[model samples]
Target: MKVFLAIAAKVRGTGVERAMAVARRSIGAAFPVPAEEVTHEEWREPGAALLAWTNEPGPAITYAAGVSGYLADPRDLPAAAAGDLGLGGCYSLFTCRSAATGPTGADPVYHAETPELHVYGSRALLVHLVATGGRVEHDPLALQSMVRQGYFLSDETPFAGVRALPPGHRITAGRAEPYGLAEPTDLASALVASVRGIEGTARLTLTGGRDSRLIAATLHAAGIPFTAVTYGTQDNPDVILARKVARRLRVDHQVIAPKPVTPDDTATRVAEVLRTCEGMTSAYENVAPHTPFRARPSLGGHGGEILRGGFLLGCQDHRRKLDALFLGNLDLLTAEAAEHARGLAESWQPTPETLDHLYLRYRVGRWHAAARAGIQRSGLRIQPFLDHRVVTAALAVDPAERATQGLVHGLIAELAPALARVPFEARRWPWSKPAQKTPDWRSEPGDALKSAILGSRELAAIVRLDRVEPLLYGPRLPKPALVWHLATVATLLRPMRMAVAA
Candidate 1:
């Protein structure tokens, strides 16, 4: 059984209503379910109001989208009724309040405004809650569990009372303050060492993009053998470029074709993967589903962002155009949502002048907060861009040189011209052309054999939440937004979960 819960509130203006309406319509379109056809019941009483909806009674998916006040109170009788009725399978709880509101200790306990969004999930329930007007008090046990599982996000500050897992679960925060100078040579060695430390057959997910390619080239130069993996539908640019790199290196390369997955299968797979990893199941449900091969000692191209000076570089490059675009869409988001994002940015100590900081601190933070709950679930080992010494060195470079100086791939190209010839493609590639082009790699003779040797049944069981409708939206949610949210959540959760689980 999977259930989702959310707490929603009526905004002062039409922003909340409009956003909700858009979200609901989007979810409906994606899921293709009629609103009126949805089975529903509503309850109204003094100091309490309730609405419940379900489809296909037994072991069915249910989601609750509630207002912050509603979530704070959650009328005991109604909660009991839900439990008695077995109302939700996988639950998502959303805690919502108005952005205009501020937290007051003296405010109504049930209706106080909050700024945090908390989401939790289990086989039987999924909780998604957002604190709209105030900050919700952290629950120690919940926070600990989330951290151990790698579900929490926010690089600026640690959540109060939460600690990273002991021993294996802990990745040394490493050097405390940022190193002042760039040390690519040392960083590269560390990156290589990290990959070499992994026992068994190691694979690198090569992209035409510079990050993975740099990692791949480094490994190649180090004389470490690695099988490269790529994914896409037929003739995808990444597939083409990865093959070129593999051919140049004379290493095994595999391309995974995307497959349409069903909801039940996704749910079942995610639950199994989470159990195996002993972590929370998150939105990156599809990642596990699409994995061509299983778990092994492996390396991924993750630290590219930090090495390249973060997404701010790109945002800066197109600031003028983006400003225009943002102005156009400003009305699309609720004022409260905007205000919530602003308040969050301020709390994070972001400089008002840095537009990029504002965007990340507010927009990205909100989305990550909502999605981090899921990432903590997959339990996969993740070596983020922040972990690599090369990245650290890159960060140490003058901000002018580090920011949009060039693609990290370009830097790798400078280091190893021969390896740079290998092609990779990502939507965000700095270059206009695809990374590398080659003969169809998916049909290569040894691809299937390699998959058989490296794939894991456990990894395969991780579900793609985007494929599961009920987990994403309540009976009332819009389909498109549900799909978007599902995909976003899956990506965040799967990698983190895999990292922690390993």
Candidate 2:
């Protein structure tokens, strides 16, 4: 896995060193592969530096295409070339969009803003807190949001005094402007161009969904050879239809099976998934064993559905609908958390017509960002649908056309007619054998579920233990989904708690 931890400080000293050390240890311990520090350098600002480690060829950071120009070092960052930092091929995966450090707060703060997908900015929150010697504490509103929706809305995170940069916001200006991608004709053209821009062949995560199918069709039309990878059992419609789609295109297809785990490894695996997801998603939904992709650029269809109005289907009244959906479960919230929960809709700036665009920034930007980060641990990952040009074009299409998936259907027909021949798998057939599902901890023969929740003092403090404890032995059990959400949030907080305690 290729990863980096960079700090920008007012002056180079012991604090910066301590911050970097903590970040490296925190990141290294959570992932499957150990992150060895391979490249470290100090920049012009007395203490500013970028430290990187990788098993891959390039650094995770790259020069971003921004107001400056394509590939131009806008800020003239250090010209030093190390193992992967400056060797530059197309380092688009985690490109640095903008960076700035302080007018001094208690001490200097290090800010590195990258236009990367899936992570939003939680990965860098640790550095921000540690560099300033800031205390770490659970943010109640963030906890409430996580409990209700599995992830935060707007820029909320699970930590107080620390917030993720809002989606598509420029760090220096604090603006949420639409990301522009030069200009490509339509969705297909924009996707093809983006994929072509990657340094190597892209690995497509093919599924039965319309989003991935559109990507597959576009790649086939462009004559780009890409491997289609599916994750699920043979009985899974996604696996079945993905195979059909791959065969029609005559491209290589690979399926990764879902394996059931023993009770002994359940806790360990759950913690790893928690670290990967940043605790924004449930580990129960993703308990399958995952093998990292062979070091290659991976392409995902994230944010595509939003383009076709999949996220904004039924609600004409955006304000009323969004509030009803996100704002609830306030009984357990602290006063501050309750206030923050009430403010979510305002932060999103939702309106009836622009709801689709808002969902992109709200859901895709925040929740999808975490999922994308988890996948990147496998290798470099990119989402073509979120490409600025495609998003711009998709948003421009008539609402009626998008609602009926007119844009997506037409593009698939144009790109690869053969693909359109195979019907999209919206739902499995009534008689189709059920795909293998990951067993819940209760099903595992042991005290896995009880140990996980009861053992976490941090979790007990946030969630009422009395409510969760009795359900563990249940004649009636706690919802598996809720338990997963609780466990994940607790796992994320554990390391930070230990750091705070130390």
Q: What is the C-alpha lDDT of each candidate?
A: 0.35, 0.53
Q: What ranges in model 2 sit over 4 Å off?
A: 1-33, 37-42, 59-97, 100-122, 173-185, 198-203, 231-236, 254-266, 285-293, 314-321, 331-336, 346-354, 398-401, 430-478, 491-502
TM-score of 1: 0.43
lDDT string for model 1 (301-393, tens) is 643554554445555444453343233222322344334323433433222234433333322322232332233222223342433233334
**Highest lDDT against the true fold, candidate:** 2
Question: Which 10 consecutive positions of candidate 1 have the poorest summed lDDT?
Answer: 99-108
Cα miss at 300, model 1 (Å)? 2.4
Per TM-score, the best of the predicted structures is 2
